[model samples]
Target chain A: MTEKPMNAVSNEAVDSCGCGCGREDLPWSGRGTDLPITGCRFSLYPMTDDFVSIILGALDKTDTSHVWCQSDALSTVYRGKREYVVDAVAALFANAWREGVHMALEGQISRGCPGDVSGDSVLSCEGEAPNASIVAAATQPALAKLSLYPLGVENYIDDIAKVWYRAEELGLNPTSIHYATRVEGSIRDIFAYFNDVCALMERTVSHYVLHFTINVNSPTDEEE
Target chain B: MTEKPMNAVSNEAVDSCGCGCGREDLPWSGRGTDLPITGCRFSLYPMTDDFVSIILGALDKTDTSHVWCQSDALSTVYRGKREYVVDAVAALFANAWREGVHMALEGQISRGCPGDVSGDSVLSCEGEAPNASIVAAATQPALAKLSLYPLGVENYIDDIAKVWYRAEELGLNPTSIHYATRVEGSIRDIFAYFNDVCALMERTVSHYVLHFTINVNSPTDEEE
Candidate 1:
């Protein structure tokens, strides 16, 4: 079989951090002043009933601390430190599954570089953001996209739109039916997020015979 | 928002049924001689680790009655009556999730047409295949594609290759890194499968955090 490079296609839009942190100018060692970050862009599709409330309910239940979570009619995007975002996703899927909700999710997880950092005002964190020391010791940031589909839901457009409205109210321009976000941080953090997200999706959706996929890219400084 | 037709793109390969059943010649009403079928084509990606035996172990635990299931290194494929196939996937994912294995999956669920019926020996069923009357009352067949990514597992290529060998032994091409399949039957059967599969996946994989996606298509005779 042909071993194709996973990240051959670069379709996602990468915008500079709006905070004007000059995140890119920071040293690769992350020692002087720049703090490394982990981020992701994701979307979830509920395949069962099309009631908009289910999607909205799940989004509402999620904890956004350490992650900037936003949704549009098509999907939701989460960006922030890798650990908290992963935890948030785990909590979201667990609650949905316990409530017998069926849905599918798609996401891109990454670290080592800054992703779309616009709208940091809505960002919530348990404590102060990471410092240069945290970045210096962390692994190179990486990126990956994942998907999960719980079977049985249909006519989800209305519900998706409702969530989109909420995101719009939060000042996010969630206009695309196809949701995309950028993430940057240590490779370990990204992998951790990837692993945790996959685990949760599998546990919840697999029992229902749902199908899912994940493509990961961990770029090193040499590769960059 | 623009309401785009879901199945606007036709990239998947479609082949005629080899059973000489003349399924297409049958009336759209599915009344006298033809039994409508619901079918799905799917692939699973174990995102956590690369242990092939674990994935095979999960597949080994599945019940194929009412569906034809196959796998290669890259992914697994299931086809058959919607109800049976759905049941089988639910069982498979549930067992895997309980075992704490993480993986992702991709699938296509479709009705109104038969797909890749060339190999029928591998077909497994609890009772006889559907009769003409059963097909007659069944709704038009529908199809969809889905995905699930169980988090934490990694290095799955070796394990995938091991599965590929099994598919090759069964006479499947089983070479490409990408996996795709097809299913056919009534919409009810397909929906049943979808709901059950999602439920099972959710129940099994939720604790670990997984990601997934599913796209469905149910076509009426009029649309054709």
Candidate 2:
């Protein structure tokens, strides 16, 4: 069967550099769909408990291919009010049998595998087991519904509220600025004002459609 | 007086690419300065009637500097959205004069000077006419406080609102998504949901500080 083309706009897991640099995927930094690894175009390190100390050092470099990993190795990416345990250390390679995009996810898998997940010994294995319910055994296609990391609505709404609250805690206000700002108006009142506007937009637009079209020209650096 | 070190961020117009890549003052595009223009970037086209056929089309590859500009040539660019003309285009060249950053600008000047502007025929003969408005004339040192383009609030706010409206239009609900999605709970909803979150972030963040920073290091794209 012929592989489908990736569209730049529609691609979620696919990576493409907008720089127009012509260099598709480089392993280091944000050049394309690369994790910030110091060496190598890409590396797939085996995650384990005391067996390794990789996650501690390059915590920021890990991507989302790791949902079955658990360790202090997980770096929390704060979306807004919600924080997800994003394991950068074990990114890309989701076990040898895995095919397709897998992020190094860091979360605790509950005892007793509920889904198709079967392993030598998940509890004792170095890598934290993900929700068997999410990944399903690698047999049929991996469940597309699972988050690279566990998340919910809180990641969106609650976290935004959290950041604002944090800003309030930081005491950075409209007048707190040092320069003559475009925000000459009241930013102290902006949070509430913006919240209202968002509410209105949400209410109005929620009735519309997102118009998702599949694009075949999108490129992912990791693919080639 | 001694000139400052070349390393310092200067106010003068410096076209790093050297071809009509727009001005240097507003040099950076994406990534809060994290992303600069990659290769030979393109400048936005000029928007006035005089610009449409007269100046822009007649521009030559060697015409980097406008020292020899005719009165009619300067009229269109110096015309409207006065501050944008100066702030985004003119000032970049001004600094470039001091620092020697050369580049080609895509657009052109024209005879379409606003009526309010002085259209002295004698001044035109001298190549020293008020083709553009001197309305936004100001000096350096007031750079941060300058109102050359005081539309920051409107731009950022509008951006956030626009994206939010787009997502809400998606009308995601419980039936569409797969996981614990607040609405449709489908896998695709995650991306839409995040974009919505980003829209909100862009909205709220615009109000905080013009010097805001964002470091988004996500773990994975999505393992499908």
Candidate 3:
């Protein structure tokens, strides 16, 4: 696979420097999904002795044909259009879940990063999401911590505060902490909340990221 | 607690809007530890049926007197000076570790965020780190995925590339992915590598973040 220059928001050619230097003329607010590259790096941890099997089995069951995926010892990365990346990841988690085992997954999803244009080949694979059936099969309550970074925005805190407000309005129980907002609900609602926030931000911000850690099937604890 | 203005790198007071509005006079590279505020939000997950006991017991054993801590259902947050924040978190994780059970801790340690000035009260606490002994007592090899965000930098990829290069030089077996760089080593080494990278970035970027997930005592997986 050869590195190719993808069009910036202004349809300008970006430099191989991977810094959007040539695209400086385009206003940061002008960015959108017009740049089709999106990326997610995630690691799943199943708290059972059979973790290796659960992890590998989930990978085998999930269809990642639509995205470019690379798995290393520490984590797995999926890069492509936003929908395909999220679909593959959601299905991976659903397939990994076992009723009695506690599990957690940590990941970061980022879009419109200037450096991410190198792997644009995967965006060509276009069709409906392949893993919808698997994601529909799993429905579990999860506790999540989400931190949003609206990079390149001058008033980033405002963007975060707005998102937090919406999360509260949606009854996600968003409690503000130092670096993140805690939300508790079904996996579907949690994921939808994130998608909503990202959709809202896509109208303006160029480079944005959401970092989330989700835990499921925890042993009941009175202290928490 | 009432909110108060803190001095920015230029010694200018930040606006109450929490978006570095009044401090545009300062160059981003001019920022350093002179700001005297840091923040960390972390969660510990133990993969056992008796997780409640292990988690609560760890919190009870660890001391958070030197930093500001807030615990919610999803996670715990600590904010103060950089050393104190790290000390509290590292000690918390060390205290939480139990032999023969798989456990994971995820956290974000960030410095120089402009909106972080609201909690400066905790910075006045003085003295050496309170939990150094606890951190020294625990030494477990861990596998970690670390993602650094040098916010507000024009050439952010360059900053990340530099950190990845150093991780390789330190024999951390760094692997680059779409959104993060993975490193495998002891917990102490992983934390140290992050500290080293943050120190290097302190010279230039005013706002930066390091997000990490560490897993220990995993049931050996042959696939990995």
Interface alpha-carbon RMSD, every candidate: 24.6, 23.2, 13.2
Order of candidate numbers by TM-score, starting with the best: 3, 1, 2
lDDT of each: 0.33, 0.20, 0.64
User: Which has the higher DockQ value, candidate number 2 or candidate number 3?
Assistant: 3
TM-score of chain A of each: 0.40, 0.16, 0.78
Better of 2 and 3 by lDDT: 3
lDDT tens per residue, model 2, A1-224? 11111111121221211111111122212111111111101122221221122323333333333222221111122111001111121121223212221212211111111111132111222344232222222222111100001011111233223323433443332111011100111211222222232333233221100100010111111111
Among these predicted structures, which one has the highest lDDT? 3
Candidate 1 local lDDT, A1-224, one digit each (tens): 12221112122323432111112331212111122343444444333333234445655665555565543222344555555655565444433332222233444443322212334323446663333233223353222222222222212233223332433443332221111111223334443434443343333321111122222221111111
Which candidate number would show the highest DockQ if scored against the true structure? 3
Candidate 1: how close is chain B to the reference, as a TM-score? 0.40
The CAPRI quality class of candidate 1 comes to incorrect
Q: Give the alpha carbon lDDT tens digit for every residue of B182-205 in model 2.
A: 222222232234324433433333
| TM-score (0 to 1) of chain B for each candidate | 0.40, 0.18, 0.77
**Ten-residue region with minimum lDDT total, candidate 3 chain B:** B1-10
- Tens-place lDDT per residue, model 1, B1-224, is 12221113122222432111112332212111122343444444333333234345666655555665543222344565555555555455433442222233444443332123334323445563333233334354333222222212222223223332433443322211111112233434543434444334333322111122322221111111
Model 3's TM-score against the true structure? 0.75
Worst 10 residues of 2 chain B by lDDT: B142-151
